[model samples]
Target chain A: MKIIAVCGMGIGTSVLLKMNAEKVLRQLGIDATVDATSVAIARESRDAQIILTTPDLVDQLQGLPSEIVPIEHFFDLEEITAKLSASLL
Target chain B: MASPKQLSNYPALAKAFADNSIRVGAIALDREHAIEMAGELLVASGRSTPEYTQSMLDAVAENGPYIVIAPGIALAHGRPSEAVLEIGLSLVTLAEPVVFGSEANDPVRLVLGLCATDHNSHIDIMAELATVLGDAESVNTVLNAVDSDQIRLLF
Candidate 1:
């Protein structure tokens, strides 16, 4: 599966999430490609299956094909995993 | 690196400084600009000056990801000596995202502006804010909030 982690700058926290998600995916034995980008760039890149970001920016996505997983806390691994698992299916 | 325990001190910090504070309008344009704007509020509320604001940015820039703690939130702060008259904190949310550096996962939407009189005090508040922000649900509540009053309710 392909996943895109998005924020305002396409750096910083989104990259951190990508790193954490990579570790989590590895532990779960899930083979998924994760990329990070800004919301603007994410809008342009349509190859991902899921988009992860804060709930505030989730509403900004007016029309998009990817399913958005609004992440409130970037440090909550369990919550992030739970949300990811639910969305991936 | 302070543990989550160290981060739980944000509430007292908030309570201590919330009085006599003014809430500003939300910036819908650039997220990075929100950080600066929030910092300005923090400085103004604390009766600080421009030097303090520059110092805050410098501290964050040197320290790396001080503000971009979580996903969408960025807590911009600096050493208290830079321009702190008193301890202060402020919250700013962007209607849109703004880029910071070149991290594959940045463009922060929420900025929690902070200013402390010293490093010790700053660490305490940082710890608390970190803990509070670690919760997905709580972070969502803050992010989805419409006004400063609503944002204050979360703290």
Candidate 2:
């Protein structure tokens, strides 16, 4: 599966989100490639199975085929674990 | 605290804290005030122009409070541009929590300001920072830190 972590600027929190998601995915034994991208580029990733981002950015990703997951706290591994599990597992 | 191996791999983080860019138990009147303090730290460290501070506020105004990336922390930054003279990070732990209009991460007590000359230069710094902030124990230490020395020891 393919996952994308997004923020206004791809270089900041999005990268952090991508790392955390990769950790959670690994712990869950889920095989997926997670990429961190900007708001503009994430919209073009049509093949992404899940898009993890802040709640405010969720509407910006609407109409995409991917499951747009609204992440409340990027540092919360339990939250990320539960969200990804419900969506992917 | 980050592991010794982790800090060894990301020496820039240790350098940043050693430079005294961290303010512990600061008082911020509101969310914007918290972000402004973070920006001021970057400017005080000579990492970015004074104008970079306003740009961070503007980004939050335009993009909302997504910078509140964790339950009690907000990382303030704007796009890479001329305002940034170099890559830097500044951290401030508020004496009183302030709301940033984030549903999940409201009342942020820690504000981290970041400035980079370009997109890729700070990737390692961000990764190191993520490792430090990702742990709840470390987050607690950050929130309760009484001085910058205590924070520096975390890395």
* Strongest candidate by TM-score: 2
Clashing residue pairs, backbone N/CA/C < 3 A, model 2: none
For model 1, residues A59-86, the per-residue Cα lDDT tens digits are: 6554788888876556777877888878
Give per-residue lDDT, candidate 2, residue B132.
87
**Candidate 2 lDDT score relative to the true structure:** 0.86
Q: What is candidate 2's lDDT per residue for B1-155, written digit by digit as tens? A: 86664756458787554366899999999888999999999999888998999989988898788888988889899888999988889999999889899988888999999987876777788778988887788889888889887777777
Query: What lDDT score goes with residue A31 in model 2?
Result: 88
| Candidate with best lDDT | 2
**Number of the top DockQ candidate:** 2
Count of backbone collisions within predicted model 2: 0
Q: Deviation in angstroms for B132 in model 1?
A: 1.3
Off-target runs (Cα >4 Å) in candidate 1 are A1-74, A77-89, B1-11, B16-25, B28-32, B60-66, B102-104
Please list the C-alpha lDDT of all candidates, in the order they appear: 0.63, 0.86
- Give candidate 2's error at residue B120 in angstroms: 2.2
